[model samples]
Target: MVSSTSEPTVVRVSQKGQATIPKGLREKFGIETPGEVFVYEDEGRIVVEPVPSPDELHGIHAEGHERGEATERLRELRDEEKRREAKRAERLRPSEDE
Candidate 1:
């Protein structure tokens, strides 16, 4: 399913629980077939997200790369994210001067 950003597009889901993403939405989301997308729930809604390719990430650098490299790159990205969250947390906290 596409995000709340666009007008709702009704799609018929197969009995097998698969649904075809529409062409315009696919192009908008950059969902090339023979590729994969990440599906998860957000606030009781189904969210479909494009899985970032290696070129979109640092370290691993390319597609057809090994899982280990992907894992490493993911870990690095997560760590970077944690650091950013920590900084944001600090900013949100009450300052000593307050």
Candidate 2:
């Protein structure tokens, strides 16, 4: 993989001390919204990480759990369990099968 570097970009902080990360960096880091987390190095090379709020965590979980219907949920869970059991049985089977 090619190592890509970003051009120097200036970000201005408002009186409220809020700064917008550059669009290029945002796209590069997959940061689309306010709740996303990020880590960056400062001039001293100190790593700083932004923590997401409880609401953000809850929202992400909610979006993941929204599979439309309960039947779909059960079906997916059952399918996953079946795959797990098959893998376990395969592992437990004799090496002669190979």
Candidate 3:
């Protein structure tokens, strides 16, 4: 459902448990991947959040734009982390001269 709030558009879930987040709202929240965790609260109102994951926050570029994008994206992210760690350890070692 389209929202009227000036802050951020809100989508109400129907009895079928389906809700379409407004285009503007999705863009504002930067929902590039579907697995992105969302926190919600119910107190006469509903709140949504995108929980940060180290893999998502500091990972490789997204992949599989057409199919299995989520899996591909996450895999790429993990691989990126591995590469970063290797580089970090290499830099921490003492040089041969020392």
Residue 62, candidate 1: C-alpha displacement in angstroms: 12
**TM-score computed on alpha carbons, candidate 2:** 0.36
The whole-model C-alpha lDDT of candidate 3 against the native structure comes to 0.56
Q: What's each prediction's TM-score?
A: 0.54, 0.36, 0.37
For residues 1-98, could you state the per-residue lDDT of candidate 1 as single tens digits? 54542445689999999899878767866778978987766456576766666566665646777768766765565556457546865867899999
Model 2, which residues run further than 4 Å from truth?
A: 1-5, 39-98
In candidate 3, residue 27 scores what lDDT?
Answer: 67
Model 1 scores a C-alpha lDDT of 0.69
lDDT of 3 by residue, 1-98 (tens): 65532343456989999787666655655555564545455344344554445565453344524555556765565556457546765877789999
lDDT of all predictions: 0.69, 0.53, 0.56
Q: Best-fitting candidate, measured by TM-score?
A: 1
For all the candidates, what are their Cα RMSDs to the real structure? 9.4, 15.8, 16.3
lDDT of 2 by residue, 1-98 (tens): 43332334467989997787766555554555765554454344423233434543454445556555444643465456457546865766779846
Positional deviation of 53 in candidate 1, in angstroms?
Answer: 1.4
Candidate 3 residue 90 Cα shift, in angstroms, is: 53
